[model samples]
Target chain A: MTYCVGLFLDDGLVMLADTRTNAGVDNISSFAKLQVFSTPGDRMIATMTAGSLAVSQAVMNLIQEGVQDPETGETATIYTVPSMFRAASLVGEAVRQVYRTHGKAMQEHGLSFDVSILLGGQLHGRTVRLFQIYSAGNFIEATGDTPFLQIGEHKYGKPILDRAVTSETNLIDGIKLALISMDSTLRSNLSVGLPMDLLVYRKDHLEGPSLRRITEDDEYFLMLRKRWSEAISEAHRQIPQPDWGF
Target chain B: MTYCVGLFLDDGLVMLADTRTNAGVDNISSFAKLQVFSTPGDRMIATMTAGSLAVSQAVMNLIQEGVQDPETGETATIYTVPSMFRAASLVGEAVRQVYRTHGKAMQEHGLSFDVSILLGGQLHGRTVRLFQIYSAGNFIEATGDTPFLQIGEHKYGKPILDRAVTSETNLIDGIKLALISMDSTLRSNLSVGLPMDLLVYRKDHLEGPSLRRITEDDEYFLMLRKRWSEAISEAHRQIPQPDWGF
Candidate 1:
């Protein structure tokens, strides 16, 4: 299990992903789930994945090595995609290829070929975009009305994102909300662990993104965790008590 | 789908369940998922169901009509149970009986014989107890350290319960937490909807626990929903921003 969230805001994109992966309770391990492909001054695309580690890893490996476009016979890679749209299509195509190869064998063993990908970034001449690419190779982009996308262990952390995020939100605030959302998930579920990767991509700047590896020793995250829990309790305390004869 | 939660505290028990059930997005309806079996001063047992409507309804019907105790060859009902532990077993037995009768048939029809129950209350002369009964007729009790249990669409509402609930929490605060938790689920999930049923059982004085059917017009619930969302946003606002230089 993993928890990855991406926020598409007015200024940029805020992406975060947990490193924990597990087949069973006893087989837990840490592996980075955030991948970046960038060309200085041209494009900076970030993708986070969730679901079957095997499927996601295979898809990522194919994308990193540059997959061939089935129709054109030309190599299409995340770094070389002409637009953010094509980048999403490339990722989706990679997923389909992996499923086509492994889906049948996995199903026989009662394993799912499921994987979800969140693609976010900007191409030099194109507008910033965010997409949620599914296992079936179809994708949905986040628009102004719905400005965020999440994959894996999503429900536990969604209420906050649903209430606090919007297209007009600032990148810093978006990062804060993403962390709070991740905090809620980490607290309630053991599958999504710490040492998360956080990346912020400023809309027009293609000179790469600010990446931070958040771990237990990080002072800011520690403060945020403590304060967020206290704030929630304080807020819970302030809500007017039921007046229907408690 | 349903979102039902039960909290076991030193003072009493808090139980809440949403009413909406659906086979598909278009086939939705409101059906009471909470049931109370009380024998005045003798006992009061509240059970909340989640999962296949058919399985839950069948189990409820069997419990309501009194299931036979295989060991004693006599009718065993919630009202006749000697202790809260036995009451949980009674509900589990009812569920198993339903599964015995319909499990294979339901599977053949591409349906699941899936149902999870949260049973909480007290039997006179015995201790107050809360049990999360599984589909397989087994259950685990809520202890002092982990004093709450939830089922169906539960993840969205679990963080608050994880952080704020405990064995020492008073019934009023417990009920407040439960409502806030339910509010989270209601906002994030369409499958769990309005007109929830709430019940609170105080230890020892089992004379029909307090019950409230919260509908869209309920003033207290509406206020709680509004204020809780505001509180969450306010909390989000207060968390210190990243100092890593935007």
Candidate 2:
């Protein structure tokens, strides 16, 4: 299980992914689920994946292999895709290809070919865009009305998104809210754990600043965790408990 | 889909259920997912159901139809259960009976014998207890360390429980917290909606004066819905988004 969220805000994009993957309670391991594709000033595409690690890794591998347009034999890779839209389409096409190749055999063994991809970033001259790509390889682009997308273990962290996330939100604020949402989920569920993979891209920068692994020693995250817990306890103390108890 | 939560606390028990049942987005109807069985001053058992409505309803109905114990010719029902633990077993047994009757046919129809239940309340001469009954008819009782069980669309309402609920919580506060949790789920999920059914039972007081249907128009519920939304926003505002966000 995993939790990956990408926020597309006016200032830029905030992408966060937990590294925990578990087949069962005992078979837990850490795997980096956040992938960054950058060509300096030309393009920057980030993908956070959840679900079958095999399917997602295959999909990512195939995506790196690029796609060829049937009309013209020219190949379009993430780095070469003409627009953010095409890059997203190329990513979706790669997922479709992987599904076509590996989906059937996996299903026979009672495995569902599950993989969801969050692709977000800028491509040179194009506007910053965000998309959630499904296992079927179909994808939907985020718009102003719905400016963020979450995949895997989403529910435990959704309330904050519903209340605070908006297209007009600043990217940094979006990051904070996303972290809090993730923090809430991490506290309630054991499947989502650190070290977290966080990437923040300022629109048009065409590169992510501060790509880092957030481990236990990370000061900001530790502070955020402690402060948030304290705040909740204080909030509970301040709020009047219901008068219904005998 | 439904969202129901049953909490066990020092004050007593708090059970809440949303009233939405849907076969699909288009085929939605309101069906109470909560069932109460009370013998006035002797016992009160509250059950919240989730998953395939047919399986749950069948399980619930079978529980309602008292069965003769093979060892003893006497029949037993929820109200007749000797303890909350026995009551939980009876509910689990009824679920197993439903599976025995309908599991194969549902599987043939490509549907799951998917049913889960949250049972909480007290029996005469016993302490308040809570149990989570799974589809397989196995159940786990809630201990003081973890005094709540949630079923159906549970994630959205879980944070509040994680923050405020304890074995010693007040019933009125428990009720309010449950409402706020329900309100969060209602906002985030179309499959889970109003009107919600809420029951507050005081320990050892089998005669409940606090069970009611909270519809869209009920004044107290309306006030709660509005106040909760306001409280969330106010809380969000008070939290510093992040130094980075600024």
Candidate 3:
């Protein structure tokens, strides 16, 4: 299982994903799940995927290779898409194409062709957008009322996002909340492990200095995890105890 | 869906369960999921269930009616059980019987005959035990190393237990942590709602004065919910921020 979260705030987008992948309990491994596509000053796109590693890799490859735009008769890739929505559509098409090519063989072996992607970014002149793309190649955009999207092992980390995130949140708070949420998931589930990938997209900056790979040695994350646990324990102690007789 | 947790401690047992039941989003209603049986100074057993309403109800009925023990050829029921183990066996046997009677018909209608129960308590001469009974009637006990068990919509509430619970935890602290865990589930899941039922069993006290039904008007719960949220936000503020330039 994987855990990926995308936050859409007024300032821009904050995306995070864990790198753990496993075929079974004994075959655990880590692989980068976050993908970045950017043509400086033109557009910047970030996608984090969860589900079948094969299918997600295939879709990413197809997107990188580009496809013919049905309307313009020209190949449209993540770089060349005129809008965030079209870039999302291009990703969706890539998914469908991969499914058409590999879905049947996977079913023959009783495996699912499951894959879900959190897509967030902007085109130079367009406003930033966030979308959750499903396995069927369809997608839904996040709205201000529900401005965050999560995929895979999501429930454990969701309450924090539900309570702390909002459209008006700045990129810094967004990243903090995302890390706290990820910390909660990592503590509860073995399927989701360490070595996380984080990216913060500033509103108008098309690129540079916005990505970090967090491993066991990352001092900030280590401190955040320790402090957050202490905070939760402190919070637990601060709650008023029920005055019941027995 | 339901959210129930059982904690086994050196001092006793603490069990908490939400009563909300739903066939779908529109068909939600409240039904008590926690059942308690006590034979004064002899023994006490509590069973909390999650899954198909019909299957659980039937299992409860069969346990109440009694069954012949295959090993001794004597009738066994929760009240007559010699130890906590036998009481759990009785509940497990009841589950198997209910499945034998209704499993196929439910499957024919494309529904699962699924039900899981958390049983916890003690007999006067025996140590306290907690068991999580599966749909097949097989069960696993909570040990000193892992002192808590949860069922149904469990993930959202698990991190707290993972971090805070242990065999040496006192009864009051156990109950507090259980409530905090349940509060987390209640906030994130619509399927698990208010009017929760909580039961605390002190070792060797076959007994009374330790159960309460919490409702929307419950003052302690309201305060805990408010304070916990604030504590989390405060903790968030106290964590060190990433020193990145973008």
Candidate 4:
């Protein structure tokens, strides 16, 4: 299991994802889940995927190929899309294509062709947007009321987001809340591990990777871990005791 | 959906459950999920159920009827059981009975007759014990290593228990933490709601309850809600901001 979150805030956007991937408990490996698509000032899109690694890799590979090849006018690629919505559609098409290629073989082996993705970015002239793409190759956009989206082991980390996140939140503060939410889940569940990947997209910047790669030993995450532990214990101590008799 | 938690500590045992029951977003009702059985100084066992409400209700009804009858050769009804382990077994048997009687009928309607229960308390000469009974009538006892157990909508409230609960913690403090855990879930989900029922059990004293019935307008819970919000926000503010551009 993995935990990935994407936030679309008024100031910009924030995305975070864990690096642990496994076929089973003993087969764990560190794999980067965040994929960045950029073309100078034209567009910038970051995708963080969760579920079966095979299907995600197939979809991502098809995307990279489509973007690199400028041949016969085939279905549009992320780089060629004029709008964020079209870019999301392009990603969905790739997912469908990958399913046509791998779904049958996976089913024969009793494995699901499961894959879901968090896609967010900007197209130079338009506003920033975010989407959660399902395995069925369909998607839903994030609205102003619910500015954040999460996948995989989401429940343990959802309460913090429900209470603390809002559309007007700034990028830096959004990252802080995202990390803290992940911190809480990491403490409670062993399936989601460290070495996270995070990116902050400033409003209209069409080039991604503003900031990336949080290693296991990053000082900020370490401080966040220690501080969160202390904060929870401190909060538990501060609540007044209930007055009740036996 | 439901949220119920049971804790076994050196000071005593604490069990809390929300009253909200829903067949979907529309069919909502306040159905008590907790059942208490005590035989004076001999034993005190509390059982909290979650999952298919029909199945759980049937299980509780059976147990309630068993205590009032003499024909059912089940000598191990919770009220008549001699030890905490036997009482837990009785609860497990009740869960299995419900599943046997209702499982197929529910399956015919494309429903799962799932049931999970949290049982905790003590008998005359034993220490407090908490067990999580499964649909199969199998159960596992909580140890000092994992002192608390939760069922249904558990993830939203788990971080607090993971961080703050231990066998050495005091009974009143345990109850407070349990309430806070429930508070977090209540804030994040519509499926879990009030009026909450809480029970505290002393190690050897059986018979009646210690503290119960936390209604919506209860002043103590209201104050707890207000103070906890303040405390958490304060804790967040008190944690110094990251020096690195976060």
Candidate 5:
């Protein structure tokens, strides 16, 4: 299991992903689920994956190596895609290719070919865009009405995002809200653990994104967790108790 | 679908259940999910149910009528159970009986025998207890360490309960927390809807519990929803944005 969230705001994009992967309770290991493809000023594409590790790795490898268009025999990769929409299509094609290769064998062994991806980034002349791609090679973009997309262990942390986040939010506050959402999921579910991979991409600033690896002892994260907990306690305390006269 | 929660605390018990039942998004209706059986000072028992309406209704009817024990050739119903634990077992037995009668036919029709129940209350001379009964006729109790149990669309409302409610929480505070939890689920899930049933029971009093059917126009609930949203926004505003120099 994994928890990855992406916020496409007015200022930029905030993407976060946990590193934990487990075959079972006893077979847990850490694997970075966020991948970044950059050609400096040309483009910067970030993808966060959740689901079968084998399938995700295969799809990522295919996208990185480039997929050929059957109609034109032309090869295109994430770094070379002309637009954000094309990049999303490239990722979706890579997923479909992987499914064609392994879907049947996996189903024969009683495994479902489950995978999902969050693709968000920008090209030099294109606008910053975010999308959530499904196992069927279909995808949906994040719009102004819904500026955030999440994959894996999503429900536990959703209410906070639903209540607090919007497209007009600032980049720094977007990061804060994403981390807070991640914190809720980490506390409630043991399957999603740290260290985490975070990327902050400023819209139209194609020089590359600011990236950080958040570990267990990160001071700012620890403070945020503590302060958020305290703030919630205080907030609830302020609400008058129901006067049902029970 | 339904959303129901039960809190077992030092002061007593707080139980809540939503009334929405839907076969699909287009077919939605309200049906009471909470049922109470009390003999004034003798005992007071409450049951909140979720899952297949047909299955839940059948089990409820079985418990209301009496289920006969094979070993002693004796009949026992929820109202006649000797202790709270026995009452839980009676509900579980009713569920199993329903399965025995309908499980095969439902499975043949590509339907599941799905149902879950939350039973909480006290007998005249016994201790107060809360049990979550499953479709298999198995159940688990809520302990002092983990004093609350939820069923049906539970994840969206879980974090607040995990952080706030405890065995030592006062009855009034317990009611407040439960309502807040319900509010979260209501906001996030369309399957769980309005006209909720709430019951509050005081330990050892057993003189019948305070029962309320909260309609959409309920004043306290409306105020709580508005205030809670404001409190959350204000709480998040106080947290410092990440200083990672992005």
Candidate 6:
């Protein structure tokens, strides 16, 4: 299990992912699931992955190596895609390609080909965008109405995002909400552990995203977690108990 | 899909369940998932179920009809259970009996045998107890360390319970937290819908559980939902935005 979230606010994008990965309870390990593809002042694409580590790594490697466009005979990679849409398509094609290669073998071995990705970034003049790519290689973009997308162990962290995030939200608030969301998931699930990767992309700031690797000892996150818990407890405590006269 | 939660507190037990039952998104209806078997001064047992409606209904029926002990040839029903532990065992046995009768047939029909139950109550002269019964006829009791159990669409509602509820929590607060948890699940999941059933049982007050059928128009629930959303938003807003020097 894993948890990765992306917020596409009017101001920019906030993408956060935990580093924990496990084949089973006993075989837990840490791996960086967030990858950044950037060419200063040109394009900055960030992707956070979740699911079977093998499949995710394979898809990432495929995207990095580039894939041939069947009709044009030209290889296009995440770094060279003309638009965010095409970049997403390239990622999807790479996923399909990986599926074509390993999906059958995995099935025979009783392993499901599971993987999902959150891709969010900007390309020079193009507007910032966020997308959630499914294991089927298809994807959906986040719109103004629903400006956030999450990949794994999503339910635990979703309520906060549902309540606190929106397109109109500023970039700073977006980042805060994303972290709060991640904190909720971390507290509720053991499979999603610490050492998180966070990226805050300012809309159209193609130079690059502000990145932070949040570890267990990260002071700000520690404070945020404590404060958020206290806040929630206090919030509920303030609500008068039901006076149903039992 | 359904959402049911049971919180065993020092003051008593709080059990809540949504009434929605769905075969598919298009085929949906409501049925009472929370059932109480009370013999007033003797015993009070409440069971809340989740998963396949058929399986749950079958298990409920078996418990109501009473299962005969194979060794003693004595019939044992929920109401006649000697202790809360025995009541839990009875519920588990009921689940297994239902499985023995329908599990294979459901498998042949390509349906997985799915059902989980939350049973909590007190018997005369016995301590209050809460147990979560699995489909395999196994169950685990809630202790002071973990005083709450949830079944079905549980993830969305679990974090709040984890953060707040405990055996030491008062009954009134337990009720509030349970409703808040249910409210969270309702907001996050479309399959779990309203008109909920809420039961509060004070420890040793075996004169049946105080019950309420919370409809959409229930004034207190409407107010709680509104206040909760506002409180969460306000709580998050009060947290200072991260100054990560983006």
Q: Report lDDT (CA) for all predictions.
A: 0.90, 0.82, 0.88, 0.83, 0.91, 0.90
lDDT of 3 by residue, A1-246 (tens): 999999999999999999999999999999999999988888889999999999999998888899766677788778777898998899998898888899999999999989999999987878999999999999999999998999999998998887788899889889999998998999999899889999999988875329999898888888888888878777777776679874
Largest lDDT belongs to which candidate?
5
Off by over 4 Å in 2: A236-246, B70-73, B234-246
Using DockQ as the yardstick, the better of models 3 and 5 is: 5
For B66-178, candidate 6 gives per-residue lDDT tens digits of: 98766677889887778888788888888888888989999999999989999988888989999999989899999989989899999999989989887888888888899
Expressed as tens digits, the lDDT of each residue in A142-187 for candidate 6 is 9999999999999999998888888999887888899999998999
TM-score of 6: 0.98
DockQ of 4: 0.63
- Candidate 5 matches the true fold with a TM-score of 0.98
Cα RMSD to the true fold for all candidates:
1.3, 2.4, 1.4, 3.0, 1.0, 1.1
Error of 5 at A56 (Å): 0.4
- Sorted into a CAPRI-style docking class, model 3 comes out as medium
* Candidate 4 lDDT, B1-246, residue by residue in tens: 899998889878899999999988888999888778777877777888898888887777776665322346644456666677776677777777777677888889999768898988888777778899898989999999999999999999998898889999888888889998999999988889999899988777766558588998988788887887777655555666656553
DockQ top scorer: 6
Residue range B84-181, candidate 1, lDDT tens digits: 88888888899889989999898999887789999888877888889999999999999998899999999999999988887988888888999999
Model 6 is docked with a DockQ of: 0.84
Q: Which is superior by TM-score, 3 or 6?
A: 6
lDDT of 5 by residue, B165-204 (tens): 8899888888888988999898888789999999999999
Give candidate 6's error at residue B82 in angstroms: 1.0
How far out, in Å, is residue A20 in model 1? 0.8
Put down candidate 4 lDDT per residue, A55-93, tens digits, no spaces: 888888877777322244465677778888977877888
lDDT of 2 by residue, A79-178 (tens): 7888878877888888887778888999899999898999988877889899999888789988889888999999988987887788888766777778
- Model 6 Cα interface RMS deviation (Å): 0.9
**A159 in model 4: Cα distance from truth in Å?**
1.1
